[model samples]
Structure formats: C-alpha cells, structure tokens
Target: MTKLRQFSRNLAKNGLLFNLFILSNLILSGCTSSTQPTYPKESIDQAIQDICKKEYKTDVKVKLVGSTLWIYLPIPEGIVEKSNKPEKFIERFVIEQNNNELKDEIVSVNYLIKPVPEQEKLQDMKYSKAAFDRINNVWKVLRRVIFSMEHPEQNSPKFFVTVTADTKNGFLIKEIFYYPDFKKVSYELMSWGEYQHRAIQETEVSPKIIGDTQGLNLKYSDISFEDFILQQIQHRIRLKFQKPEAEKNADIDKEILKIIRYTLKAYGFKDFSTLELNNLATVRKITLNQTAVFSGSGD
Candidate 1:
C-alpha cells in the first residue's frame, strides 16, 4: 500500500508541472497578436520630418536613382568675404524615397561640402562657419517644408537641386524638378515669411482704467500704468503683424476692413462713430474721424 501511494503521489506532481508549462505557453502565444505596432512606415515618416529642420550653407543636391536618393550638402568654412562679415557658407544633403517599394528603398543623404568665397584674402572674417550654421541655416529647410505643404498638387519631383564637383575647389547645384510622368518643373526660390506679420492695430481703454470711478464722464487721469503697459503690448503685437502694402493689392479692401472691425470689437469697443485707414504712403497713418458710442452686457 505504501509503494502504490508513493507512485500515485509522483504521478500527481508530474501532472501539475506539466499543466503549469502548458498554461505559460498559452499566455505567451496570446500576447503575440497581429495588431501590435511596428516600424517601417512611422519611423520613415519621422525621419523625413527631421530632414526638413536641417540647414545647408550653399545648397543641397538631391537625386533619385531607382529606390535610393542621394543628398549632398556643403559644409562652409569660416572663410568670409573681404567685406561681408556675418555669414559663412556650408552645404547639406538629404534624401527622400520616390518609389513605393520597400525592397532596397534605402536613402543615402549624408554629405557636406564647403564653398569658397570670391576673395583673395580670407582675413577679416571673424565668425566661424558654426556660427552661420546656427543662425540662418534652418531657414531654407523651413521654406521648403512650407512650400511642400502649401502647393502639394502643383509641385512635381523634377523640382530639386543637383550638385557636382566644379573646378578650383568649388561645386555647383543645378536646381530641377521632375514629375512622375516625366514633366519638368522649373525651379524657383521660395519666398518665406512673406505673410508673417500682416494685421491692423487697435487701441482701447481697459476696465481697470475706470476701476472705482463710477460715472459716464471718467477722466483719462484715472488710467493706471498697468493698463498703459497692456495696451502698448497689444498695439505693438498688432503692428508687428501688419501686412505689407504690396501684398494688399488687387482690391481686397473689404476683407481688410472686416479684419480691422473684428479686431476692434474683440478689444471691447462697442459702437464707433468713424474708422478710416489712411493709404497715405508718406504718413502711414490710421485716422479716426469720430469717437465711439457704447452700451453692452458689461457691468
């Protein structure tokens, strides 16, 4: 009876161990689902976004060969011109995949070159190439991204830059843009920050100006310094965004008027007697013909 009990006990122990092993295997397999996140698409898209933030001194040369793209951007030396003191020239390379295939769809866009300036002596240049790269280098990249986002349908692949070795330690990049159907798009320098600051400024008194003075005929002497600072900052921010006159051509005066009126209303003005924007180019003035009336939900 004792021997039979021992055999049964050993068999029960083996059976429990076997059950635990099977349970662990089942749990691990359950974790392996097809819905889990993976790379390839997301990672590549992030890489492209990063490329748009880099700066090149002279120009970046890009070429598409089958699945791979080549990028050659220059790295400028601190060799500034005899007179020009603030800028150094450098180049950078970036690549984007054109074909949809993932097989061998690798991009090689990591090269730099330096462009020499047209000066006999590289003496008076004080700032280094790193300094120029720090300041104005990313502007071109930002412009390209803006252009791509703005004119997606109209832009074609032929619109790119090509770089090659020139004599005398210099290089040249031929700007080109090609379509998938082989149509060519002429290269043009994109205008960046063209509409950056274009708005009208409005002036208004703050509620703090009439804080405890309860009367329709409040004095301007009651206005506080805090109110003054707030108004000044608001005015400056508006002026900083004011559009250039040339951009306002083509009789869009109605649109401009609407914007100005909306801005005034937002700044807590009720009824204005008159509002006139002066096109007097010599003065650059905004003359109000009359004062504003009031009465609204404010206490």
Candidate 2:
C-alpha cells in the first residue's frame, strides 16, 4: 500500500488574531518526473544567461534541476513592494444543506474571482510592470532556447520564479507554479478563477548579495515537487480565510469541494481515504471520506 494522507495541526497568528489552520496533504504520484526533456541540460544555463544579459539588460540566474526550472531575476527595483499584499478577488460564502442524518447544516465555500482588468485598480493586478515583464522574459527566453532543441516540451512542467524585492533587507518573492496552467485558461480547460487560485509563495527575508552573479548567495531549498503542489493548495485556501473580499452567496461547501476535486483529479491523487478540514475560529472540524470527496466516482 502507498503512503496515507498525514495531518499536523498548528495554530497561526495574524496580528491580534489566531486561527487554527489545517495543513495536510496526500501525494499519490511518484516523487520524480516520468520523462525529462531531451534538451542538453548543461547548455540550459548558458542560453538563459546570455539571453538575459544581451536582450533584457538584466542578468538572470537559471538552473534546470531535474524536471523543475529555477530562475532568479533582479528586476527593476519597484517590481515588488515592501508591504503586505491585498487579498482581493477571492470570494467566500456559506449556505444551508441537509446531511445524510436528515439534519440541516451549513457548508462553506470559497472561490478565486476573476480579475476585471478594466475595473480593477493597479493594486489588484498580480504583478507590477517590472515583475510581469521579467517573468514574461523568462518564458520568452525559454521558448527561444527550446525551439533550437529537438522535440522541445514547449513548457516546463514545474518552475520556480523568484524575484528580488528589497535589496536592503534581502527580501525575495518566490512563486512555484505549473507553467501550462496559463494555457489551461486560454484553452478553456480550466476557469480563469481556477487559474488565479494558485498559491505557493515564499516571501523570504534571506540575506544575500545584490547584483551578484547567478545568485550565488541564494540557496536552493531541497523541496519535492509534490510538496510544492500541496503547499500551493494549502496557501491558496489559507489566503481565502486570511484576507477575503466580499462574501458571495453560494454553497461554500460545493465551492471548496470543487477546488479539491479539480486539484486532486489534475494530479491523479486518489490514495487518500479521508480529508480533514478544521476551523480554529469556531473550534469546528469536518472530516470527509474519499467517497464524499469524489462523490461522483461511484456512479
């Protein structure tokens, strides 16, 4: 039998408030990638470095370790701010429903609302000009480089996008994401709201030399790809409760169930017997078995 879904309970404090956060994950897939690209892995760094320096006038550090591509960019100073980010566009809701015991209960749900660029304030956008440009540059450079290789994968299955936010304090903003998720929105394979829901971020205060060659001062965290995905889902959920927007009047239960359903199905994770969700605010806990989670599977 494979490993089971494990749970570790802890209380998180935010200013004057402390909410019990439930953080647990079940990874059903293998830790390693099934297929590594055919590209010459050694030349990857050189190609990215040359492109960054010559084309963007910015020196970038890139490494393709296993299936994940790690890129660090020292974008223009204001790309990342030194303050807390606004958590808008994520809606939460609750509704009444009856369970199998013939009793009425409340179900909670949260959704990542779509961004209306026209009506959205500058603060609402995910990236500042410099941040967006630098990330786009990385994507562009990778595509150019991969085009020269035989049978390019066209995208990185997993990637780490790290940017230097504050030089004085050595603040770094790191986001781990699945590259093709952007395409999913375009292809209508997933909703724009679903795409926006991704969240595996590390706004670390790691001290490091600024403008140094290849981010030599930065250290690579030895984290597994599956762990990253779990963290992504956990953080995304945490944000919904942390800094929420207007509460929508929908079935929060179904909303959350849909989120979990999409994520689990996408990754082929089905080994878990039960999923646990706890609310420290109310001292309430709900455990849903695999049958309830994937309710349609029996049919």
Candidate 3:
C-alpha cells in the first residue's frame, strides 16, 4: 500500500510539472507574436485585393481610373453583338477615394434586352425613323417632368405632370461618387433619356392636410451635384445586385432609377439635351449640357 501511494504521488508531480511547462511555453510564444504591428491602409487595400482576386471573373480588371479605383468587369466581346440575349450584364465595380479615404463603391450593370442585330444593311428608313421618334418623345416628356419638379415655381399645372418613361426599353445611366469638395465631386448619370427628378415641395402632403406636424418646416436646397452622383451609382448597383426572383417580378431597372430621384430629391436638374447615336457603331464623342436650379435653403 505504501509503494502504491508513492507511485501515485510521483505521477501527480510529473503531470503538474508538464502542465506548468505547457503554460509557460504558450505565454512565451504569445509575447513573441506580439512583436509585429499591423498597418491600416496596407491592410485595407490587401483585404480588398484578396477578396476581388478570389471572387470575380478572370476578365475583370482592377485599375485606378482617375481618382477612383475601378474594378472593370467588361461584358464579353462576343456578347456585345446581338446573338444570345443575356438577361443581365455585369459591367464593372468602382471604388472612389476622398482625401485618401475610401469614399464609396459602385457596381455598374445593365439589363439584357431583345431585338437581335442584323449584320446586313440598316433597316427600313421609315421604320427606323418612327422608332427613333417614339423613343425621343418619351425622353422629351421625362425631361420636362424632371425639370418641373426641380423648379416648383414654374407654373404648377392643374394636374401633376405624369412621370413616364419606356419601361420595356433598355437604357443605361451612370452614377459617380466623391467626398469633401462640392466643386470637386459630382455624381452624374451618363445614360440619356433615363433620369430621376422630384418636385421641390411635397404638394401631395401639405401641412394643412396632415395636422400632426409641428412647425419644423426645414427646406433643403435641392440635391447637390455631389449627392446627385452618389445616388446614380447606388441606383445602378441595386439593380445589378437585386435578387433574381425580385428582378423578374419588378421592373428593377425602372425602380432603381425612381429610387434615385425620390431618395435624394434631386429636384433641380432642368433643360437637358443629349445626342442620339446608332448602336451598331461605337460613339466616338458625346457631350451633354444640363441646367440645374440652384438653391441655398439648406445652408
């Protein structure tokens, strides 16, 4: 019995010593690991780069486009021609920096439309002209409505101007982001005929009609050019990322455009014109001039 006890005591002592040794080893390793410090900006850029490298396609290229760092995932060259009509198209992802700080991220995407392209000569002139006129008419009406919303004092008609656009028609719009300087950063969509604009005042929701309101009638100067750019980019991203199920049921493209107009209340852009181009040939040069109403109510 004495011998048995001595053996058990020896085992216990050895086990305790082993545990202590392990604990000391762990502490020393942790101290050694703490020697290196992490870099903030390098860490951020590396994380982003790693993520893009793993996930996006091979054709998707990343580059610093101007002040913005862009991940350009261009549509395939073959896909550009009208043969296989893809439902949705992935364009590119953009990251903007402000004062060397991450400003915003934008993903530009497009919807797939029908109407196959013919390699042969152009279609009948009369048919083409009529189609062009129809599209132009819708574009003109939209511009007028947006203009009216930006300028509330511009003769409020008996009825609110009906906001309309070609729902079935495929169009593109661009959104940009910048921070800090108002003059430096401006978000504008490049797509012609597709735009969002809202009335300066909520004519539908008047103060007298809804009596629950206190006297906090703060009017903001219409959307700034900087804010305008962000909203446009947001609109495009939502459409691209929207769930497949939801996109099928909803006019996601149109919904996204409307969201931009309503979200920022960009009731300032008025009287804009753009050149119409043939889809077959690439457009070399295009310029657009838009007049937007300026206000300092918010300031």
TM-score of 2: 0.59
lDDT of each: 0.27, 0.46, 0.25
Candidate 2's C-alpha runs over 4 A off are 1-39, 76-132, 146-149, 153-157, 182-192, 205-213, 221-225, 242-258, 296-299
lDDT pick, better of 2 and 3: 2
Which stretches of candidate 1 lie above 4 Å from their native place? 1-132, 149-196, 199-259, 262-299
Q: Over the full model, what C-alpha lDDT does candidate 3 score relative to the true structure? A: 0.25
lDDT of 2 at 158: 50
Per-residue alpha-carbon lDDT of candidate 1 for residues 1-299, written as tens digits (9 for 90 to 100): 23223322222111222212322333334423233233232132233335533423244333334322223333333211233542232112111111111112211111111122322222222323442342233323322332343233443222222222121123212112122211111121211121112111121222332222122222212222223223332322222222112121322323333344443443443233544443322223343432321221111
Query: In what order do the candidates fall by lDDT, top score first?
Result: 2, 1, 3
Candidate 3 regions off by >4 Å? Answer: 1-46, 56-59, 63-67, 74-299
Which candidate number maximizes lDDT? 2
